[model samples]
Target: MRDLEGRYVNCCSLRYGLSFFIHFCNIAIAAQRVCLSLTMVVMVNTTYSHELHNSSTNELLTNVKNPVYDWSPETQGLILSSIFYGAAIIQLPSGYLSGIYSIKKIVGCGLFLSSLCSLLIPLAAAFGKTSVIVCRVVQGIAQGMASTGQHEIWTKWAPPRERGRLTSICLSGFLLGSFIVLLVTGFICESLGWPIVFYIFSAYGGVLCLLWFVLVYDDPKDHPCISISEKQYITSSLVQQFSSSQQSLPIKSMLKSLPIWAISFATFGYFWSNTILFLYIPMYINSILHVNIKENGLLSALPFLFAWICGILSGQMADFFSSRSILSTTNIRKLFTTLGLLLPVLFSMCLLYLSSSYFSTVIFLILASATGAFSLPGMMINALDIAPRYYGFLKGVTILVGMIGGLISSTLTGIIINQDPESPWFEVFFLMTAVCLACLIFYLIFGEGEIQEWAKERKHTRL
Candidate 1:
């Protein structure tokens, strides 16, 4: 009887194992089937009528289709600076719109339109001066669309706890784009012409836009593709999570805040000082320091790369202090902001005074780059901290002001450099330092955020 019972038990256990295996196989097959079907659907949807990708580096560089094109230095400066102008100026309105509508929709539309503008740059260059200017203006507006929409996404997607890393990642795109461009553009430029750079950017814009429509869902709760684990993670982290109860924030009240002005001023200083690097750094190096073209481009890239790295590092620092619970959020923000702003201002001044040799100029830029890290945790992080709800709008507000500053800085620097290149660089450097210092002191006292006070404040514009 015992032997018979043992045999029966073993048989039952074996049957149970076989059934479980079958069930597991069925689940695995179902999951694969679901994945396949979803992928097919997404792929089809991704083929939007407005898909923007076209052209290549070699094609753009070598294409002389624009026989009317003139590649003068001034024209180049206008082309580049106009993009910043448009990006900064358009940010406010675009961001406000993003807050009112779906950020995903705003970003997707902006990127698609911007990619189209990018493709037409060569066409503009081919037409005449007027066409190039028009294309550049369009490009800048497109950037405003891209930047502001990104801020909207950041506010919604990034939780307070993880905002630091997310901000770093997003902001790093500016430099990462530059770094990738630098590494890749050299080969492209060597093989083709400068036109290829814009072509490459256009391609990037298209791919990113397509991905946005496919993977990105506007509201966290409304997302179809998100798994349960991801849904839990996002909702748990947001301090002011988006909901049906909340409506769009008031634009007028936000614009009137002293903190906004302070942030704007600091951003202005950043753009003002940095534009020199973008516009005339190579010329300065070649004229003042006598560096070769190959060396200058690499050296020029260093500051931006360092600034990007510092942003990542500073973010980690903020998170570290936050976890300890020793420092108030205000203090952590203030500390990093002050450091980011102050160091750049101070180092910028050093350029004015220091003329030891060619090496000294490079050293100044490297130090300034290191200091540029300060902006990351301060303005970039603090903007999100103050109003994670209205990040797109605020980013647009401050960025627009900064672009105005850039116009002033670049214009003045250009005029001064033409007359007396050496002394003017120094003078501008010191002036920027003073301006930065002024912004810093102001922020120390007036620029801060308190959540209790958040609802009490309203922006000036109701609409």
Candidate 2:
């Protein structure tokens, strides 16, 4: 009887241990899947930019003489810009839905729809430019929902101390996705044809969506397979440091807040420069450096690879500072935000003078991208710091405003570059630099790291 009872106790212990391990694994899996989803969206959006600019236009077009199907520089720019229109429209709605309803369902449905749209792109292109633009718009809407939903998940999963690192880990997926797409899309287009790039990436998205549905839960309490001990640990940690009062969103208050506007403007400047650099880097390399398609792919990917590493390191460092109480959260956010924006501004300005030297130009590009990684732990996480409960809504608003910068940059680049290939770049680079400086000044004056009163629950009020 003694031996039998001992065995039963041991079995219980083993079961608890296994559950704890599974809980740990969930964090890593969540990060990986989010990275994959980001890769899918970025891959689909940027694939055509390289294909149209570098590949044979005759192959891409159904009728070269039919103005609608002609893959001109202007047409390529418009198509890239079109996605932002749809993305901007859905950001607010998606964030509100994620906060109020099931984050898992919103993310899964969005990714599935985006993947479906990607598969339809090849067919849409065959129809006409208008059809292709429509497909991109639909794709943008789905991806916007998916991206916004992920932030809501972080609010539930990330502990207060680990917020910077964990959020960075999740967002680093953006850089990684961009890197993978830039590196592989060129080869895929060259070998299997550009259409295959969309098909393969879309298929991967479908697979990732299935995995996300199986693995993720909306909150720790909802995860069936998690151990009681692990769940308690998570709950206790969160409750002590990051508990939200679950207040109803105070939209009027938020809009009137200067700190919120600072975040918005800062993000707008960051995205403006980022969109121009990422979307056009390959084209820029091909045009100025005169590298072949394969070289352009490899070279363009290098900046993103460095940026991903830098982003992860910055995140870890930010978490360390917070955990050890080395610096106030506000100072940490501001310092890094300045480093991320200011360094890139200087680097971009240097590009204007270094246009003649291939080696110098490449080095500056790498520095700009890698240093900009600081923004991950800086401005990107500021929304969470200021409004833990309302991060989804805040993120949605920031992204909505920010993506307009992307839209304008893309469309303007197309027009300017086409007007005069030689000197047009000067204006583009100058504009990016000026915008970054202005936003940086505004953020430094007004940004805050403490939770806003409006985000807290008041007596007798329900969230």
Candidate 3:
């Protein structure tokens, strides 16, 4: 079939198929991680804690079917942040391994391990808080490897021209996961009990893991089912950017690069803001806004649904600009990254002032999330832009920085919320906004879109 652009299309193209499969993999990765965000609401008994002051939100304590623990705010913070700690430990190593080994195997194994961890969370919870924390940490490590492997997969499977769209499609799965979990988990907790939510998602993940092992290949050339035309298109587009010859890593060069630092800091900013929304928004809505469990799930989910849409559209727009030469790669990256970071801050500030109005608060949140997704097509994939050869390793470094920031942000948020209890949201929002702005400025000043000399393949000279 010919598409509207007059290009021949293969409905069964393995490259596109791979993008979608990874998309589902990402969905599983996110669901496993964020299940705690909503479930924790029901899992913890706020009334049981002496540290907690009386609040109207304590009304939720009357109706929970599942057993609730007397977890202090600090303890809750540790549970939420433990995943990031495990993820950070694996990020660099996983990135390096993904680049050297089979992306298919690395990603598959990671997802399978993560799925296994997810399955054990309910069992862990029965043992004690410590067991659950340990389970989450292991899940985080596995998901980190899977996330890093995705960047490596694109290095081998994605055409240079199609990179933005393909990567965005895969990354959008993160938002999709958030949307589903936020929409469904609370209702499941209320109706069937909290453990069922974990059981259902983990079971789905296990099935997808089996499919991943059967269908995915490390590269376009390796897939037996990929069409010849599609294989040639992908391989030819990537040939100049990749090399089979192994060389020692240019660690020193990367350490000194301004662009690398820029990506790392920008990632930190993104993760800080993201951690607040993904992990804490449910708490904010329930505790502060007094939204019920079902309504809270639905409202929190709305922003992510819009964000997923915006992510996909921005990816398409980015590739269009690149293919048509309407803008330089640097400009495209800057423009989208700016939109992704700046407008969210503006919208979030608006959310604070308009918090008294429930409708306006939700609208602003939706706008913030929708606009923030532009970053997916922006700095999120800039490593691929400047260094396809080292994209996997570079992504790992940036993500490690991001995970550390997320870990700190989650812990700090819990500490801050615990200290004030009555009016902590404003202070938390302000700190998050300030950190995001500082990092965005660093990226705008130093980020680059051109490939570095150190990233290019070098010819070996025989002595």
Candidate 4:
């Protein structure tokens, strides 16, 4: 009887397994993407320190250390931003291909390729900045494809009511990865050397790529290990909502879609703020709060840890509200997006006022990140809402827009800080706030809950 009950449970839970696998996969993706943010702090030359002094003093601090390279802030920004350039090129094509081909294969292959590029990065650094950037770009391309494929997977596997929960759980892996990376990177740089960071994270992605190929399937009907009952449950749930898996691209209609535009704008703002958090928070802790490298890593990671925890919880809350019909889908998405984006802006603004208080600054940053994770259940999964059939494609478009935002954010941040590393933070916060508020307002006004006519399934006609 125990064995029979176990079999019955397995017959209903394959979707959950899929969600967990993707969750781990996202962790791998994020680890590789964010490892460099902290690692670079230790890699650069320190002949001239960029650390700032309090308002009472004006002396520039100088330190001598065994630094690996002497790349300037502008060059570092270019290297950080280069990945987005490669990712932007692939997101649209990979997103469309994932919808048309096997999502399992596309995602697995992308991870494999990205992992390989990660292994090459340390060696590339020996040649110079350009070589490192090239390797990073390749990694970005792989990550872009794999990340987009995950969205397509949800279109096939997730029930409408479960989307917020499943998608949020999966995306929370991103923050988890960032947390783990930031938490360990400084220690690793100080103890094991920075190259080991690349090797460790790359090996993780390679192993996950193998497991993904072996265990994951593009659709419920195609999964060999899924029980008949499980397969039937997924298919039946999605049948009325989506047409056949393959459909021609509705280019013209999508071009005219206000909801799509709303998603794109919101995604742009979301990623801009996220990029700042992921790339610059460590620098802020080090430069403004006067934290050492090791403590900087731990402190930088705190926000992401809080964000990850809150993201998973918010997913459940969003789903509860959705399932109980307490709020319409549009309202739910808007509500979460507003909380995530707007709250962070307020917290970030507080940083400008309390820049001198390390404890206060850390608390606000943590609060900001915790609230920002709400976006995971907000605009992030909205593509699945308006276009279940073309979710992969729409996700690609919006993510591409978001990547552009990130690219600009990283590059522009360097330019802003390089102008005067001491006093330019206000400008940075102001720009991020403006972009987020503008985008959030647009999303609230125009976003939709139901499927678009162009995205609806078409009935077959007799020849």
- Which of candidates 2 and 3 reaches a greater lDDT? 3
Question: Model 3 segments beyond 4 Å from truth?
Answer: 1-12, 46-72, 286-288, 354-356, 419-426
* lDDT by residue (tens digit), candidate 4, 317-393: 99888767899998999999898889989999988886466688889878866778999989999889999989888
lDDT tens per residue, model 1, 1-463: 1132121122133222322322222222122111211112111222233322464664443344212233455655555556666666677689788777877677677777777776776566657767766776776676567666666765555555445545664565565445444445555544555455556666766776676677666666677755555456556666444433455576676666777777777778777766665556666667767777678767766776676678767776775566556676777777887887677667666766774766787888777756666566676556776666666677777877777877888888878888985567677677777776777787777667454245333436766
- Which residue window of length 10 is worst by lDDT in model 2? 1-10
Better candidate by TM-score, 3 or 4 = 3
TM agreement with the true structure for every prediction: 0.78, 0.82, 0.90, 0.89
Over 78-187, each residue of candidate 2 has an lDDT whose tens digit, in order, gives 67657767788899998787788888898778888888887787778778779878988887788788877678876766656666777776677677767777666655
lDDT of 4 at 290: 81
**Candidate 4 has what TM-score?**
0.89
Candidates 2 and 3 compared by TM-score, better number: 3
Estimate, for each residue in 1-463, the C-alpha lDDT of model 3 and write its tens digit.
Answer: 5445544345367777888888888998999888887788878877654433462554445434466787887788788878877888898999898888988888888999998998898788878889989998998899988988778888888776677788889999989998888778877887788988888889989999899989888877878887777777777777888887777789899999999999889889888887776667777778767977678778788888998998899989998888777888888888888888888878888878866787888888778767888999889999988888888888999998987788788879989998999988789889988999999999999998888898999887999
Order the numbered candidates by TM-score, best leading: 3, 4, 2, 1
